[model samples]
Target: MLKKLILIALFSCSAHALDSNIIEIMQYLQRDSDLIQRGFFLNKFDIVQEGIEKHKVDFNTLQKFNIDMFLDEKHINYSPIISSFLRNIKENRIALEKFLKDNDKIRAYEAFQQLDYNCMKCHALVRGW
Candidate 1:
C-alpha cells in the first residue's frame, strides 16, 4: 500500500489511475520467474517444470481479474493490450510446459527466452514506453 501510494505520488496519478491487482500480479510473476530462471541455470529441470504450471495458473487468474476489472469500457485504461499480453504469456507457459515434458532443454531455453522477451514487451507497453 505504501508502495502504491509512493507510485501515485511519483507519477502524479489520479485515484483510479492505478490498478493494484496488476501490481500484485506482476510481483507474483517476477518472483516466480526468478525461481524458474535460477532453477534452469542450476539444471533443475523439475523445478522449472513445476514453476511453469504455477505461473500459468497465475497468468490465467490475472486474465480473469482483468476481465472483471475492465468489464466496463468507462474504466478501460489499457486493458485490451494487457489482456492480449496475458494471453501471450499463457500460451508461452503452455509451450514451456510441453518443452520441459519432452525433455528438450534447447527448446525450453528458447521458449523461456521468448517468454522473458514478452514480459519486457508487456512492461514497456504498460509503462507507455
Candidate 2:
C-alpha cells in the first residue's frame, strides 16, 4: 500500500510538471505572436519606433527560450495552432532578414505590413485574438 501511494504521488507530480511546462510554452508563443504583430504594425505605420525597438528585445527573449523541448510527446496538448504560429514567425523573420540584407527600407516596410495583416487574420480565425 505504501509503495502504491508513493507511485501515485510521483505520477501526480510528474503530471503537474508537464502541465506547467506546456503552459509556459504556450505563454511564450503568445508573447512572441503579440510582439511580432505589434512590431509589424509599428514599422508599417511609422508611428511607434519604440515598439519596433521593443520587438527586437522580444525576439531575443524568444531565442533565449528553448521551444523544441516542450514539443515532445510528453506534452500531448499540442495542436495545429502551434505549428502554424511557428511557421508564421519563421516567414516573418525571413522577410525581415531579406529586407535587412538588401538595406531596402521600402521593401522591409511593405513586408512588415503584409506580415501584420497575416498575423491579424490568423489570430481572428485561429486563436480569436
* Local accuracy of candidate 1 as per-residue lDDT tens digits, 4-88: 9899787755424446666777788887787789879999987886678678766766766534453455435666676676677
User: Per-candidate TM vs. native?
Assistant: 0.71, 0.43
In candidate 2, the residue pairs with backbone N, CA or C atoms under 3 Å apart (3 or more residues apart, or in different chains) clash, namely: none
Best by lDDT: 1
Q: Which 10 successive residues of model 1 have the least lDDT summed?
A: 66-75
Q: Once model 2 is optimally superposed onto the true structure by TM-score, how far is the C-alpha of residue 67 displaced, in angstroms?
A: 11
TM-score of candidate 2 to 2 decimals: 0.43
Cα-based lDDT for every prediction: 0.73, 0.57
